[model samples]
Target chain A: MDRIPILRMGDFLLVTIQVDMHDQLAMTLQDDLTSQIEKTGAKGVLIDISALEMVDSFIGRMIANISGMSRILDASTVVVGMQPAVAITLVELGLSLAGVQTALNVDRGMQRLRADVAGKEADDGRHQE
Target chain B: MAVTKSEVIPIRTEHDIVVARQAVRRLSVEAAFGLVDQTKMVTAASELARNTFIYGGGGTLQCESLLEGARRGLRLTFTDQGPGIADLSLAMKDGWTSGSGMGLGLSGAKRLVNEFEIESVHGQGTRVTITRWK
Candidate 1:
């Protein structure tokens, strides 16, 4: 089974989706990402979809699921680098991606992920978690 | 309503869905579809292709490059011989799913294309056709 790699970087995990993922591939990614966050206790996840030319409902729902799942596991997920055309088609497809955080580029996504994780950690530390 | 080029791809598995999208994109580009048009066509193809596979069991995607007057367009037809949809209106409603999906496949694909049409027999099969003009 071909799998998308999940890279670990300090307190964060980075994934760059570079292919037009099939339904199975996308499902595998959803499972792999949640488990990786749980095992590594990662504080954040950054997904770069710049290489993907299309993101239909299947893929879009996977992104939203990843974010929601990561939140329950005490992590933040930021998706970045969506092409303008892909974004336009996504809305027209009726998938507004509500509740999913996004950024224009990977750099910004990383920054947002870092800040979100840092803020959460500070609040937790003060509460003795 | 003249097809300048055409091809057929069998949609038997998830990977076939990816192939369908790529095929639609190639034909759309050859027909001089703009970037956004190509994206819309390809995305719509993805949605319909998956429906043809998952809900329809297995099927085929027919890609056509059309020349109607001065407009060049791409048309895709998905056909399957699975247990067809019983209630199409309810199925087309947003956020309604048979089991495991966002339930946006039919309605969403309709919105992304210039033309959409669907026909199904309760116990026979389903066919969805869509076109995007460039």
Candidate 2:
């Protein structure tokens, strides 16, 4: 059976989820990824979900959960390479993700992460003012 | 307990899930909840509404605004009159599906929202309530 792969990129972590993304597998993937992000203290995380064809409510919720939990851990999360069909379906299903960040590619997602970090640092500097 | 307006939408067929989910999301957005809460409520309602049409043959989705002092949230109640689940425990288990189902409906819904509850009898019917707070 294929397994989810984790890649370390600088202070960021990359998680490649290779599965049908159905039922419990989807939920388990979210739970495990969240725990890993918390354990590693990574600055940011990237998720590649391009392999998924159909995303039911389970997968949508899992993605939302991961993004939400990562915030508590102080790690920003970005999802990359989501299929257009999946995006369309999510909108149709009313799964709008406002708190989570998303990008069309990993590079863009990383850029966003860097920007977030930079912005946070700038905010902190201002807070000291 | 935060009390808000409740809307009851009748489900006549499988297509009604789309409408039900849309209504729930719109209400969540209008109530000033975050996108995550809206996502959870929508996904949970999708599962329950699908169950209503596929298993219950038809039902209704009741959406109510939730507020707890300064906090805000939403709740969805799905009711169906079709054949109720035979075994709730087995149905909750992963990969144990009935009628070509992927078997993630109920359990997935539960995980999406902060609060979830379900009640059903073999033939009486099924009622599922899910809530997400902002």
Candidate No. with top DockQ: 1
TM-score for predicted model 1 compared with the true structure: 0.97
lDDT of 2 by residue, B1-134 (tens): 96678889998764476677778868988778665556556666777887887788898888988789988888888898888989999988755678666566787677677888889999889999888788
**Where in model 1 is the C-alpha error above 4 Å?**
none
lDDT for each residue of candidate 2 in A17-120, tens digit (9 for 90 to 100): 66554344565677777777877778788888877644565566678788888888888899988877557656554456668789998789889989887887
Q: Tens-digit lDDT track for model 1 on A1-89?
A: 98999999999999999887988889999999999999999999999999999999999999999999999998999999999999999
Alpha carbon lDDT at B31, candidate 2:
76
TM-score per candidate, chains pooled:
0.97, 0.55
Candidate 2 chain B, run of 10 with poorest lDDT: B34-43
- How large a fraction of the reference contact set does each model reproduce? 1.00, 0.04
What lDDT would each prediction earn against the true structure?
Answer: 0.93, 0.76
Can you list each candidate's DockQ?
0.94, 0.05
DockQ of 1: 0.94
